[model samples]
Target: MMNPESLRTVSVMRYILPLREGGSLPALAEADDDFKYVLKFRGAGHGVKALIAELLGGEIARFLGLPVPELVFATLDEAFGRTEADEEIQDLLQFSQGLNLGLHYLSGAITYDAAVNDCEATLASKIVWLDAFITNVDRTFRNTNLLVWHKELWLIDHGAAFYFHHSWNNWENSAKTPFALIKDHVLLAKASKLDEVHSEFTQKLNPDVLRKIVNLIPEEWLQWEDGSLKPDEIKEVYFQFLSTRLTNAELFLKQAQDARKTLI
Candidate 1:
């Protein structure tokens, strides 16, 4: 696993095309390293906090033995926005002139379709456990956000996870809150042995690992509406939330198991 502190920074060399699949309106761009990356703009409508979720979620997933595309900090130049004739994209690039998030593009990767592929129950359980842990409500059948590259499943587009950060006014109060929405998770039906998966992953993801992953989020992206918390203070909240969830995983585990039983 690449140390979160050593996340590579790349410079955008060329603006390739726009990917209109998600609400963020991420675009394809070639970086100075001669690699194509799906660039997530900090200036997107979702704001910088979404980028923080992506960074934190991707790193956490990677640390937990899940396959995620390589993440890089891509530096954008305002001139690239001027080259874009589309006014919306031009404005997007204009505001995202500095640091942004990039996912190393997976060439020829196909969207995961449950109808065509059979996923292992254990791995599906692990993924479900992860979504429950992070409170990710985006991974429904309507939007899998999963890719099949080289015959292996790769997780992508985690900007919707870690959503509690959006409202930190009651942050501490929500630390151990149950994620009731996991029932809608795309992999819920295929998930089995979730209790065992929870035990194993909770042990694997200790406070140290959570701290490292939280630290990976750039301090700039840690801002909120009213600036109630400093960067370091907000970062600590992330660790506290994850730790509290892991310590209280039973609530969600049972919820998932119950949901599975209903389906069965």
Candidate 2:
């Protein structure tokens, strides 16, 4: 399990370029550590909730022993991006002045190509299981989001996970619901060991592990439009949802298995 304190905080030194492929306009920026990171702005179209999902989903995947890029708390200075001629990007940086999420940039990584690179059944099963558990709906063929770096598969762009939080109602029921979108998963046809991995994976994500990951969420990110719940209350809801989802893993596990049957 990742030490909850291991996630480092860095300051954005320079805004390199915008990665337009991402709907949120995440940019490649150099941090004070002299390392490049893909910065996800809190003020993007999805807002801070996307950052929260990125942190939660990425950390959970890391705890489950999946290959994920290093995630960090990236602080954007108030004066940053002031000279940018583009009004859109400048406004984004201005609005996202405080805190953001960054993924260590994989310099030469290529998008995962299912047609050329063969994925092992065990690896595929674990990834599919993780996505299903988190209710991630973005790992389809059109946008695999999986990348290959140094010849190893790495997961990225988890901001789309935890869709239930967007509505913030009946969250407990959402936790137990099957992820019907699993049918479109890039790895669904290859995840032959889904059943074999279910027990072992579930054992790894105990309550303590889940709590540590949820606790990593920053209080600022929890502020919603209506402000009906306090930050701590929001954190507790995330914890409860994940814990309850784990208890009902069978619901999604069976769904994945049934979905796979239709494919292979």
Candidate 3:
């Protein structure tokens, strides 16, 4: 398990360029640590909740022993936003002045193509299981979100995962909801070990690990507009949601297995 306290914090040295492909409008920025990262601004169109989902989902990927790019907290200075002439980008940067999420840029990485590349059954199964567990609906073949770096597959762009939290009203019931989107998962056909992976991950991702993952969210991101729940209470909500999902894993596990059988 990754130590939540060990997450590195780096200051933005320069705003390199904008990656306009994403809805959040993430940018490639050079950080104080002399490393270049794809910065996901908190004030982007999707809002801070998207960042929270990314952190929680990405950490889960790491915990499951999947290959994910290193995530860091990139500190952005107000001055960085001022240098941009684009009004929209400037506004986003200005709003995201304090802290944002950064994904380490993988040089020479190519987008994953299922047609040409062969994924190991175990790795593919693990990813399928993780996406199913987190309710991530973005990893379909059209937008694999998987990358090939150093001859290894790496997961990225997890902002769309855990979407249930966007509207927390029915979160408890949502946890037990069946993940129907598993049918379109990029690795569905390749996930031959779904049963074994499901059993192992269920046993490994205990409450302790889930709590540690939820604790990783910065307090500022937990602020609710209604102000009904305190930060600690909000964290507990997340823990409960995930715990509920784990306890009700059979529904999703069966869904994935059924999807795999159809594909094979």
Alpha-carbon lDDT of model 1: 0.86
Question: How high is each candidate's TM-score?
Answer: 0.95, 0.98, 0.96
Local error of candidate 2 at 58, Å?
0.5
Per-residue lDDT of 249 in model 2 = 98
Candidate 3 per-residue lDDT over residues 1-264, each given as its tens digit: 444444689999998889766568899989988999999989987788889888898998888778888999888876777878988889889989888999999989999999998899999999999999999999999999999999999999889988887777889888998899999999999999988998899988899899998999989887768558989998998899899999999999999998788887
State the lDDT of candidate 2 residue by residue for 236-260, as single tens digits. 9999999999999999999999999
Alpha-carbon error at 87 in model 2, in Å? 0.7
The local lDDT score (0 to 100) that residue 114 gets in candidate 1 is 84
lDDT of each: 0.86, 0.92, 0.88
Better of 1 and 3 by TM-score: 3
RMSD of each: 1.5, 1.1, 1.3
Q: lDDT: which is higher, 1 or 3?
A: 3
